[model samples]
Target: MSHAHDHDPTVPREALIAIAAVLLAVMGLAGAVRLGIVPQSANPELSRAAANVAPAQQRNLRFADREDGAVLVTDADTGETVKVIGFGEGGFARATMRRMAKRRMHEGIGPLPPFTLTRWQNGALSLSDPQTGETAEIHGFGADHSATFAEMLEGARS
Candidate 1:
């Protein structure tokens, strides 16, 4: 006995054409933006809020993991323990540090130079690695996460 299908398994021709047209439009827009034919809008989430302003304060900080899973933020210049983030707290700070540390390890660079945390004149905070030239704008992470780094920055001298 042979069985007959109740419905066709193929997509409509119009659907395929629509999909291709949408894809081509997206590609063209991207190309135009990349070639500077179309201006790209600044993405607040991915951009530094205070890029044009001077930093009101900057701290060279070293992050160390304690045996019990806590993270210690120390002033690199003064060698002072600035903030001790208890285990389970400071999720953002810990995650950011881990990402930078992993990159350094992959590149075979030791943790001699510490990261710089800056509070801009506009009150935006940012963390930067001088060794790798990587920067994370703290303000982009939201107020709560930004506060974590802001507190650490407050502890260090100018």
Candidate 2:
């Protein structure tokens, strides 16, 4: 038996257990992500509600569109609603472009299509059709009331 007897039984057991634990942790993390958990490490979480609002407050940002199914942005962690800007129809980019064009701010925002930034009646912000019945009040894009819109508007700017 050429060098075939050099294995340790205890080592295999320990390694197998360790691998199982790692696999579990990975699965849990992936599950969390799929369940609307944003990766703070990759996206860099926004700390405050007023991180990137416009000075005049003429426009607020929004990214909580249902079409962008993977994304789950909010004004605040406890925020039940978000401000919606550029909630375009069609595909994600097409919707954004259409909305931006409506506002007379057409064109891509540094390769990213313009997302519509519309104000809600109650004030919660959102990025979907106002008629869709999924809107909430947002103070405005980058308003003191919401941070998600602020970030989206900033990101969309050329």
Scored against the true structure, residue 129 in model 2 reaches a CA lDDT of 32
- Lowest lDDT sum, 10 consecutive residues, model 1, at 43-52
Evaluated with TM-score, which candidate comes out highest? Answer: 1
What digit string (tens of lDDT, one per residue) describes model 1 on residues 68-148?
Answer: 999888899998899999999888889999899888888888877899998877788888888887877778789999988
Relative to the true structure, candidate 1 reaches a TM of: 0.74
lDDT of model 1, residue 43: 44
**Model 1, C-alpha of 84: deviation from truth (Å):** 1.4
Clashes of each: 0, 24
Give stretches of model 2 more than 4 Å off: 1-11, 37-45, 48-158
TM-score of 2: 0.26
Per-residue alpha-carbon lDDT of model 2 for 34-143, expressed as tens digits? Answer: 78684544321132233443223223323343564433333332333433443432244334434543443332223122233543333344443332222323444345
The lDDT for every candidate, in the order shown, is 0.84, 0.42
Root-mean-square deviation of Cα positions for candidate 1 versus the true structure, in angstroms: 5.1
| Residue 149 accuracy (lDDT) in model 2 | 46
